[model samples]
Target: MDRFVFAGRTCVITGAASGIGAALALHLARREALLFLVDRDAGGLARVAAQAKAAGARDVATEVVDLADGGDRLDLAAAVEARFGGTDLLINNAGVTLSGSFEQVSMDDYDWLMEINLRAVVRTTKAFLPQLLARPGAHLVNLSSLFGLVAPPRQVAYATSKFAVRGFSEALRHELAGRQVGVTVVHPGGVRTNIATSARLSGPDLDGQQAAAAKAFSEKALTMPPEEAARQIVAAVESRKPRLVISKEAKAGDLLARLIPGHYWNVIARVLPKGL
Candidate 1:
C-alpha cells in the first residue's frame, strides 16, 4: 500500500483525552486531518480539542463517552456515523491497568479491566469498521502492550487484555488483506503516563508502600515520552506498518519472547528490577 496520507482525511481516536491519544490528536492535527476525539474525561477532551484546532486541524470534534458503557459506545458510533458518515482512520487506544497477581486480583477488577481494555476495543471496532471499509483506504490501530507479548508477574489482567488485542488485530489484518482496510497492533513499553498512578491494586500486599513503589518504578522505568511514542505511531500508520513496538525495551522484549519462547520469563525476571 502507498503511504497513508493524513491531509484532508477523517480520523477518530479513542482515549483522546490524554497520553498517546492526546499526542496523536495534536500530531495529526498538524497534518491537517479532521479529528474526532472520544474519552470519558470531558475536561481533557475539551483541552485537547482546542489544542488540535490551534495546531491546524481541518475540523475537530469531541465526544465525552465512557467506553465501559455499551449505551455510550453505541451513542458515540451513531454520532460519528451521523456527522462524518465515514472515517479514514480509527485508533482504539483507551485502556486501564490492573496491578496484582492473577490469584490475588479480584474478579470485579478483572471484569472492569476486561470491559474497558478488551471488550471496548471490540465494540468500537465493530461500530467503526463499516465506515472504515466505506472509505477508499482506511487504517485501524489497536494499542496492546509489551506485557501482551511477554507475560510478567502482577499484571495478569492487563496482560490478558493486551494479548487479546494482539490476537484480534492479527486476525483482522489477515481478514482485511484483500480489502483496503489496514490493521496495526501496537506494543508500548512503559511510556511516561498516568496509567500506573491510576491503576487499581489488589492482593494481600496491597498497601501504601506497594502502591508508592509501583508508582515510583513506573515513573522511573517508563522513560519514553508520550509525544515521542505518538510520533512513532503516526509514522507507522503513514507507512502502513502492521505492528509497531514502541521503545527499545519493548523491542527487546519482543525479540526475547520470540527467541526464548517459554524461557523468556527467566530473562525478564533477571533484567527487571524488583517491585516492577
Candidate 2:
C-alpha cells in the first residue's frame, strides 16, 4: 500500500495544547494538514491554534474540553464531525499521570486518570471509527508510554492506563488488517513534558518524595525534545507503522520487558536514576 500523506488531510489531535501534542500540531501544520486541536486548557489551546496557523496549517480548529468527562468527549466528537465533515487521522494523545504506590493512590484518582488516558481514547476512537472507515487510507494513532512497556513501582495507575492503550491499539491493528484504515501505537520515552511535574499526587504525606522523584525524572530522564518526538511520530504515521517506540530509554525498556518479562523491573530499578 502507498504511504499515508498529511497534506490537506483532516487530522484530529487531543492534548494539542502543549508538549508532544503541540509539537505534533506544528509539524503537521507545516505539512499543510487541516487540524482540529483539543485540550482542557483554553489559553494553551488558543496559543497552539495560532501557532499551527502560523506554521502553515491548511485550516485550524480548537476545542477546549475535558476528556475525562464522557459528555465532553461525545460533544467534542460531534463538534469535530459537524465542522470537519470527516477525519482522515485521529491521534489520541491526551494523558495524565498519577504518582504514588497502588496503596497510596485513591480509587477516585485512579479512575480519573483512567478516564482521560484509556477511556477517552476508546470513546473517541469509537466516535470516529465510522469516519475513518468511510475515508480511504485513514489512520489512528495512540500515545502509549515507556511505562506501558515496563511496570515500575509508584506508577501503578499510569502503567495500567498506558498498558491498556498499548493493548487496545495492537488489537485494533489486528482487526483492521487489510482495511483502508491503519493503527499506530506509540511508546514514547521521557520526552520533556509537564506530565511529570503536573502529575496528581495521591498520598497525603508522600508529597515531598513524589515531588522530588518527579523533578528528578523530568530533569534526568526526559532527555528527548518534544519536537524530535513529533518528527518521529509523523514519520511513523506516513509509513503506516504499527508500533513506534521513541527515545533510547523507551527502546531499551521495551527490549528488557521482552527479554525478561518476569523481572525486567529488577534491572530497571538498579539502572534508573535515583528518586525515580
Candidate 3:
C-alpha cells in the first residue's frame, strides 16, 4: 500500500483537536508520522492523540494552547524545538469566527480574530522556519478561506484576517521558492465544520434557532465534508501547488475572481447575505 510521504518526519498542527485539524492528524498518523498536536482544548487534543495512536502514529505530543495568547506562540516554539529539533511540515490551522457585521464585533473580538487567524501564522512560521529551512524538503500550509479571495459579504473581520493570510502565504511562497521550502495556501469555500455552531456572538445574539437557520443556509449553499476537503488539500501539497481551491464551487469562485477581478467581488457580494 502506498502511504503519504510524511513518514519518519515530524508534523506539527495547530487546532489539531477538531474539524480539519483532527481529520488531517488522522490522515498523517496513518502514514506513520510523528505528531505534535496543539490546541487550547486539552480534552479534545487528548482524544485526537488517542485516535492517532490507534491509527499507527509512531509517537505523539500534545500542547493545550490558546493561539490568541501572545506568550503561547513562544512557548509552542520552544517546545517544538526542544522536542523534535524541527518540524518537516507546519500547518497553521487554529482559527475562530464571529457571525455578525464588523460594527457588531467589539474591539476585543476584532483583536482576538486578528491574533488567531493572522498573527499566529506569522509567529509560528518565524519560530519554526530556521529548522524547516534545514530540512531537505519542508512544507508550510496556511488555511485561508474563499472569502479571502473574493471579499464575500457579512464577514468583514473574518474576511480581513483570511485576506491577510493569503497575502502572507503568497509572499512567503515566492520568497521561499528560490530555496527548498514549499508553501500552499488553502482557500476553502465551506467545509462542514462546527465553527458555525461555536461562533462568537458579541453584539446581538442570534438565538440558537436563528443561528441554526443561518448555518443551514450556509450548509446548503457552501459546506462540504471535512475529510474530502482534507484529501484535496493533501493532494495539493503533494503536487506542490502554491494555492489550492478545495471545493468545486470554491474553485469556480476563485477562477472567476482571478479572471474578472472587480466583477467577481460584485458577484460574491450579491450571492451572500448582508448580515447573520
Candidate 4:
C-alpha cells in the first residue's frame, strides 16, 4: 500500500488532553487532518482543541469523557459518528498506571486500571471499527508500554494490562489484514509524561517510600520528550508499520525478552535505577 495520508482524513484520538496524545493531536493538526480529541480533562481538551485549530487542523472537535465508563465511551463514539460520519484513524492512547506489587494492590485498583487501559481500547476499537472498515487504508494504534514486552517485579497489574493490549492488537491486526484496516501496536519507553506523578499507589506506604520511588524513576528514566515519541508514532502510522517500540531502553528490553524470555527480569532489575 502507499503511504497513509492524513490530509483531510478524520482522526479520533483518546487521551488527547496531555502527554503523547496532545503531541499527536498537534502533529496531525499540522497535517490538516480532521480531529476528534477525547479526554476527561475538559480544560486540557479545550486547550488542545484550540491549539489544533490554530495549527491548521481541517476541523476540530473535543469531548470530555472518562474512558473507563462504558456510557462515556458509547457517547463518544456516537458523537464522532454524528459529526464526522466516520473516522479514518483511531488512536487509543488513554491509559493510567498503578504502582504496587500484586499483594499490595487491591482487585478494585487492578480492575480500574484495566478498564481504562485495556478494556477501553477494545471497546473503542469495536465501536469505531465499522467506520474504519468503510474507509480505505484506515489505521488503528494502541499504546502499550515497555513493561508489556517484559514483565518485572512490582508491576504485575500494569504489565498484565499492557501485555493484554499487545496481544489484542496483534490478534486484531491479523483479523483485519486483507480487509484494508491496519493495526499498529506501540510500546513506548519512558516518554516525559504526567503518568508517573499521577500514578495511583494501591496500598498505604506509611513511610512514603513508594511515592518517593515513583518520583525518582520519573526523573531518572523518562528521558524522551513527548514530541519525539509522537513524531515517531505518526511516522509509523503513515508507513503502516505494525509494531513500534520507542526509546533505546525499550529496544533493549525487547531484545532481552526475546533472548531470555524466562529470566530477563533478573538482569533488568540489577540495571534498573535504584528507588524504583
**Total clashes, candidate 3?**
1
**C-alpha lDDT of candidate 1 relative to the true structure:** 0.89
Q: Give the TM-score of candidate 3.
A: 0.91
Q: Summarize candidate 4's per-residue lDDT along 1-276 as a digit string, tens digits.
A: 568999999999999999999999999999999999999999999999999999999999998888777553566777888998889999999999887789999999999999999999998998888889998899999999998999978888889999999999999999988998999999999899989878999999899888887888899999899999999999999999999999999999999999999999899989988766
Q: Candidates' lDDT values, in order?
A: 0.89, 0.92, 0.83, 0.93
The candidate, 1 or 2, that scores higher on lDDT is: 2
lDDT of 2 by residue, 1-276 (tens): 479999999999999999999999999999999999999999999999999999999999998889888753566667777888889999999999987789989999999999999999999999889889989999999999998999888889999999999999999999998888999999999899999989998878543888887888889889889999999999999999999999988999999999999999899889976766
Summarize candidate 1's per-residue lDDT along 32-137 as a digit string, tens digits. 9999999999999999999999999999999988877755366676787777777899999999987667887899888889999999999889888878898867
Total backbone collisions for each predicted model: 0, 0, 1, 0
| lDDT of model number 2 | 0.92
Pitting candidate 3 against candidate 4, the one with the higher TM-score is 4
Please list the residue runs of candidate 3 whose C-alpha ends up more than 4 Å from where it truly belongs after superposition. Answer: 1-4, 206-210, 269-276
Question: In model 3, which residue pairs have backbone atoms overlapping below 3 Å?
Answer: 39-65
- In candidate 3, what are the lDDT values of residues 1-276, reduced to their tens digit? 122277878899999999999988998888788899999999999999999999999889999888888753666777877888778889898888887777677989888889999998899898888878888578899999877887766578888999999999999998997677889899888788887667777576746653765577566664687888777777876677788888877887888889999798777656655543
Q: Model 1: runs farther than 4 Å from truth?
A: 203-206
Superposed Cα deviation of residue 49, candidate 2 (Å): 0.4
* Lowest-sum lDDT 10-residue window in model 4: 68-77
